[model samples]
Target chain A: MADTLNPPGQVPVTVLTGYLGAGKTTLLNRILSENHGRKYAVVINEFGELGVDNDLVVDTDEEVFEMNNGCICCTVRGDLIRIVNGLMKRRDKFDGIIIETTGLANPAPVAQTFFVDDTVKEKTRLDAIITVVDAKHLPQRLIDSAEAEEQIAFADVIVLNKVDLVSPDELAEVEAQIRRINKYAKIHHATKGNVSITELLDQGAFDLNRVLVHAPDFLTSDEHEHNDEIRSMSFEAEQPIDAERFNAWIGALLAEKGGDMLRTKGILSYEGDDRRFAFQAVHMMADGDFIGPWKDGEKRVSRIVFIGRNLNRPQLRRGFESCQVA
Target chain B: MSETADKVLQTRGKTRELDAFVVKASFDRSGSACAFALGDGEVAILRQGADDWQRIRAHEGAVLALATDAAPQGWISGGDDGRFYRIQPDGTVALIAPFGMRWVENVTSFTDGARTRLVACSAGKKLAVFNAQDEELKVFEHPSTVTGMVFDGKGKRVAASHYDGASVWLVASRSDTPRRLEWKGSHIGITMSPDGDNVVTSMQENSLHGWRLSDNQHMRMTGYPSKTQALSFTRSGKWLASSGADSVVLWPFFGGGPMGKPPTELAGGDGINCTYVACHPKDDLVAAGFADGLVVIADIASARILPVAGPGRGPISTLAWSPDGAHLALGSESGFAAMVDLSKK
Candidate 1:
């Protein structure tokens, strides 16, 4: 059977999320008004956020529904599935799609919709989750709202807008806080949401090939303050991992603590295997495959990162270390 | 592929290559004409013997829904342009309701004696009902955006599927409360058994959920490989034919309502997923369209399969049987459409 009902090529969908007044609307206006020489169907949560002159702007309700498959964290955006299906009928009219989520919404359901729906998965690829943060008020928002922390934790690209509002010391502190929550996101500083559209769209951030490329220091063990409810933890092992042991350990770990683990990504070198195994997870759902053969003369290092709440760093490290071949 | 089926398409079929995706095709009540609603906001109508299709620019955007209008002998269509329109056989389009920004997602009509009632739902919670004269009768509110709507056999009650469940309402009832059949999932499509005893909904999940209206008993039909997008009740209401699995998944609706019985799969096993299914209006046969663009007719009793047209250009998107069961109309996502005159065979 064909894996997708769609034709060969899949349209890329970039999810835009941020707290209210974090320059999300400004960024959207810029994307729509700028002569990017591309047609994009933008799905926004509010209708009058900006006077966007684009012909394909769609207002959507943030209707989230838990899947009937008994996985609690496997919720999906019902409205988005409907809108995306409708937009696909006019697939030729748009080069790509961008979804602007509500400020207070959880980005997990929006991200999981691309993973859960077979039709959505086949028709559109989740290019990246771009989260915009107000550099001035992010510290207060992170302290008050869990959604703020989550938007940062789940982001593949973070646009620190309103950078001029904060001092250099304050900016560094805010960036540190963001790093403590999500170590791998590509952070771009912007003023008035004036970042290049290239950084936002078609990043292929979810692609396994680009997974570790964004995090150059992915394999390095860096010390950072981990005081927040949601923080990042990483582990590196020099020895090649046992495929069976690694699968069992990761599977059980995700099953038990996946809800608390907002995002998990790893590139591993398995013992006696020529190809590197790339693994990714959004809550309880996980996907992995042997991406390609390891490059010649490259060090065989297996690294994993988990960004979530109440992460038992020591326990997770022991579990991953135990997967190493004797 | 059967030779007879191949011959049917070769000799009796009228094919057209359109400019945009064919969203839906429907035969009129007289079975003398069929109209195809396209993604390019146009309606193409072909008379029983016409060599060319009379095209009408019906809406400003893609037509999202289309259904046969019985009393007027035309078609009622709703489009993303937010307009409800009626297209006559002469290629004249009349605007019925203009909902400025909301996409009219579904449209249906039913006749009672001489009056034709038009029903349409937009992207939100309202389902509007209008009379044959194009005057609004009543507006029914749903808990969420109405995804699918169908009138019962008697035309007295209308059932709408939306998020979390389906709702059945008495059309003329002054009371605002509808009989809500609660299910905890997104119900994207709905169908009513010919006898109006069962209301089944195709869910966002890869399964179908149904309710026996008399006692509110739940009937869960699972195990589909993909989401069931098309559903049809056999003429006698004995079987509910659905597309999603490799074969036509026919769940028995007559024998105590398919609660414990396994479905009888037909015309598949070749691993090609069926994308659409249309039951014969007057017989125990089903025409199924597959992902590989193959169309086949399967007899429920004999399990005999006959190929019709494809392996065309794209997966079949829509299928409709003439009210007389003499003609079958089908279209694919790649804009290939055909009407097969089974009557001559």
Candidate 2:
């Protein structure tokens, strides 16, 4: 009953995306149930271009036709901006916002909507993007749908979800593959859609200025063909990783077979301070710098995701573990 | 055809276009005939046996099919949407009936004695009959999506074809007791002979058929390696012609007429778009409308190309010369109609 971070005029917009049947809605419902009277405006999707039985598929008791709680469920109708703007008119009633886009819905235009639309951007800031992945079906889905690959590429926080469904071997394979596609995204291994709310919001992954400075793109002027089998695996090492040995291993891997690596990223573990350092790589081109210390009093563990083709997980694990401060 | 392998490519005309917007099956001082294009969204009167052009923007949503009588008043066209409009030579447009649907698949006319009527069907799934006077004669329903439709000789009966099956119905009554011709094949082109006694159908699959409406007796004309795109009955019903797999296969009635010849082998022959081939009602002038917007009028005896000039910026949708044999009208996919003065060029 107190005016919190989201007061009358300063609520942030968070985008939710994942592959089809990837537990996005389940996680959202859990959040809503856990934090009810907290008052967050919600955007839910209906059918999209790829649905066979394309009809409205949301199960909220709230009458969407006369929606008044800042909650807007837009069906296949192209009235997204209209619905969101209506909610913004009564902004005093809500705390923040969450947009549940369709599984295959491309998030670029959704992200751009925050900057492009004149009315809503004035009232709210884009907060964070949380993507859920079906741990069991991701491997096959990545091969079948282009939307899946893009979902991984644009993730801010990827929930490697549905861990209960995948076997131990399959879970390991899925985690390694996720890291290969996105190096900077914070990965959270989740089961039954369980994750800490503190971890979900305000991590500042949506801060474009901060990201560009810490990670430099080597192939900025050149076109890079994607290595089909190589995947990017990214992690954040809370402590310093042995930069000399890790660089040697990455250099040797690229020298003999850089074409086999699609991408890789991590926060380097420095030799002394128990603080996270960051890095990103695209194929053989790699450049990174230490941004700032990870927030003190936070869990001091390194987090990273590697994304590339034919990623050597055994060698990468051994190589990363070998970089521990001795 | 079992499957529709239609490759529609956009093309250009030399000066303008070779096409028709609305084709009415109409009547004039000439006789019982069909008008192909519309004028100012009105009527384009084409008599059965004359070559002159009549300007009559006489309908709404453009003309689809025209009818004719000795006065040449018998004709109908199921419009672009779903409304079926009828046109009289005096430039009078009447709404015969509305199918209350989405797409008007086809509206073709055939003469039955002195009382000629037009056959109109829309949404490719509903059928109806309107007389020369715009009278609603009968209406029927088709089982599946309609691909091709035609009225048999005399206009006493109709033949409807779909992606699954084909049927023949008597026009006298809105009868569903159609002689269920067992040849259940996906058809691309369907036609009733001038006498409306036999139905000729073409498929995208690999063969063409001739079913005798009398008892469903039929003939299978073979040889196409790919798909048969066009099929038609010669004016006299003495010859049956088909083009698919890039070759013209003419099946002569009785036993034999001529062994089919490839289009490339025609005298002065070049590759043709081969959209629809229409045989002249009066003579042996066979005009094949192509995707290149070229209407090649081939004299079967010479096997040569006689390019009839017309209008279009794309492929010809359907091409038909005035029944009187005066002006040739070419219909294009771009929704414009082109009329070529046969005597002009």
Candidate 3:
């Protein structure tokens, strides 16, 4: 079969997010000016504008189409669909795109835009969400705004910028705090928002490997637990799940509780099949694909990660555990 | 002669997989060639070379929209690759312009004798108007991303549909402010009535909204089961046809307007939604493609339905009738394309 469902050639989009004054612009300037030969179309809001003195990079304003759904997420989604769809129409425009969100903006709406819109879903892939964190002030900022924690939870890569301002022990404590909020993200330390541009771009942060590595023991047990409302949980099984049942359960689960799910991802071992089923969901929108078969001597395990507020871990665990083949 | 033309009827001819999941199809002025916007970011030109249609693959990514140009007698296509291209009947492709990674969501062409203009919109909420020589004429900034665009009768003005409403701009004039027509929801697809009396937009809320140009009277055409993606006005401007449900909904544009009167349904039922609709250029006939990939032509006067093509690879995304009404071209989401001769022998 020629695979009727052929994935269209999609442009990769990387989102830059952090609270106000977290060195996001400094990092953005570095990424743009760094001798990385790749050309990028940077999408940035003008309110918290970067004082980018470099003539090397130019930032332009883009109005995200507003959706009248009475939901913040849907509103962001409408603009993204139009903007992304519009950007995809031109040829040789850029190798990739970078979107810088407002300081107070929630990354969920921006990330969910990729998954929900049919046009955006077809033409652009969400590469990664890089959240720049102010190491010295994160503790106070976390208490000041929920968006601070939301950014931490949704980020695939957390740039702990301004590390020079914090003591070594304080840096370690901040790292530990971020881990407690989001155990899946890869953390990097930076002083002036200066980090490896290569490492940040094309990171495939949402790929199967990262999801598998972070949540392997998630289903087995919980350690380094946090009492915060926003947390991560895992569900795993050694045996394969009934594909139909699993899909039905997940579909209903997302339909009912998707708003509370900041992020959800999983790799499953299907019943009677060697092909591994890897899937991920940003809120309600979910995408799954069949990866390669299980390697020799590799454990046949399925694992899932959910990061969000008021996550009913016990209910989700029980529901996922019930999906195993009888 | 009428009977002969009617007997010639609608018949499927020459199905090709030159590309995949066609989003739009267009036929040039003479009907000698047809162009298809493939979902895989490629434009396939089927030229009438010698005996049969020869396929030519035209772009690098999924072609989002396609427009037919009459003067140069070719087709223009915009793709996800952020490039606009003009493909001639001879299969020669020219890069019209590039939008630097912005998806050219829509491309529309207007021609007045030797004067030609190509207007395209990109992701940054900007509209770039170009002359025939591909020179930038004017760039219009919008409050939101544009959803759809349509040209007026004289090809002098263009209306762009967006989040809140639509904007009507006189492309031929500079310093003329585009007449902004406001409504409340996100408008997806837009069309101007043939007589230029009103503008109607397909809303995201599974309904249709319209505004009379003369008085800006807001007209609501609601009660649809799905979002109306395609809209067409009859040649006489008596009816406006839309695709949203199993049947083609024809709103009467006669009398005072489509407000007080009820809409007439045609060529539908069987649980298959009409995915696209195209009115014949010179007749009261309309061709509608169903979600099942079936294409049928219906005469509004006689209420007769003739199956043009069907059981296709996927849902029909686009249907275009040549300017002279000599041929009808249809393309589906699964890369299936066919051109049917509609003229009398």
Candidate 4:
């Protein structure tokens, strides 16, 4: 089961993140203590100073540092590249890696490292970005800092921790708040980071089927829209899109609005094609491939979800509709 | 300068009409021929003739790995199709091993006197060794999936680099225990010195780690701006040239070893980082490819660099010196290739 889930040759890397006091350490400790029959190399902040129970705990002292002013993308990534690579040299040491980013840290640069670097890309696959939100304070934290909102937007799975501290209605409100920024991320309710090991690992959130399965109506929900500048816009088309036209439109759109577009994903049904085209974009980079043929009884449809700022829903809708096979 | 350029023979442009992403390049034993694996699972083998290369549909998917065949005239390649094959200089291909549906990560073959052994690593954490007859010899399982593999100089042993370190296995007999060279970290590339006295690995952490075979003494070479993806040792094993920064750093492996000796930095500046390097099979000259898609040949004693390939293709992905040291074959990520003949100079 350990090697079956992840493709052979490449190791799965899980980015574990949470705002301050959201029980990230507790979740990390739980992942470490669980008898999951797997080894994890945990990269925590100031690991050398803190005594963690894990045998393979690596202390990374903010390896990502700013090299220039106003450029949020300067973290050397070479540090994590070094650690992940160093961990790779001892191939027998661990099965997977868990990188726990700091509370205030934005996960964008970290995620970009996996995409931008070739050496890191060959040996490791980013399994998922798991964000553990402080259920009690996330409401205000989202408004207080952009870092918190960015983390929620980039997450593949959101663990709303400390549910006991908030009422059920409050919990629903927090869930609604998270949905406004990222409707694609799988959300789980937890009181003390008590979540199943299966929910965290081997979650092919990056896979098109698994991504679209959990959030079937993500792009259609209007009530969950957030007031903050960040918003999630989901779109669906009943008719299949002309693959070439759709590609050109998206390419031009990302080129013009990529700076504001945080993350975009879609499972598109194309004309003259039985297989579904699964696409995802991070900033300016986008990649898509055919997943599989639509089931015999399944309805053919195209759905897309974008999380970003100042999104002109009407304009984007018109642009996507124009790509339909004409 | 133009007169000097006229002395070196250069063949440029795409080997085939179709665009491809060149994954790797290799030279046969005599250095008279070369092979380049494409992203679409096809291979283009070029002989000594002028632009004499033909494309072969080598696999069903992208061909990711290629190694010089144990024989003197062919190559061994593995693909994402989960199959490994042996391609002769004449375009003849044979399946060496099949691994159900797993991607074949790497393949390396070595010739020991009369016997030739071909080893292939699959995505399923298994290494299958085959004899010259192409019969399966033995399959060894690793704690993790193997990243890279190489055969020692004598062809008696093969080392497979994986999670913790590398495992050195004896190909002649199955009873011998694989000596585990443990240096904790992800080791992507592995190479054994020509003399078989030292084995070094290019770590995921922008550095290199080596071991002296006799006493298992560890050698650490660190502090690079980027991850070192390419490594090459001189014919005499006196120097180890690696790519990590704008230039190639050649570490002195003689006398007191690379321990405290200051490395000789060659052909670096601006923002261009070396992506691959290859030492002449018989000379002190080394060929280095940069991230800017340029290939330069550097002389050890003279410290002079000659531009063999120009910029504008893509990052140079692979470089290899022909056996006679007369030609240097270079490939780029953009599926372009060029061969520079040094004999004319």
Question: RMSD of candidate 2 to the true fold?
Answer: 18.5
Candidate order (lDDT): 1, 4, 3, 2
lDDT comparison, 1 vs 4, better candidate: 1
Candidate 4, DockQ to 2 decimals?
A: 0.03
DockQ category of candidate 3: incorrect
Candidate 4 segments exceeding 4 Å error: A1-326, B1-18, B116-124
lDDT of 2 by residue, A1-326 (tens): 21122224556767789987888877776666675456676666434323222111221111112111121221111123333533443344557777777887655445544433334445665567788999999999988886787677667788889898989999999987876566556788898689877677655543332443344333322223344643444333334567787777767765555434433445554676554455544344444455455566755455444555565555665666666666
Is candidate 3 or 4 superior in DockQ? 3
Candidate 1 local lDDT, residue A201: 80
Deviation in Å, model 3, residue A221 alpha carbon: 18
Tens-digit lDDT string for candidate 4 (A36-120): 9999877776533235677666655454433222224333343576456445433445688888988988786677667545667
- Please compute and give the TM-score of the first chain of candidate 4 against the native first chain: 0.85
The predicted structure with the larger DockQ, 1 or 2, is 1
The best candidate by TM-score is: 1
- TM per model? 0.94, 0.46, 0.69, 0.58
Q: Supply candidate 2's per-residue lDDT for A290.
A: 58
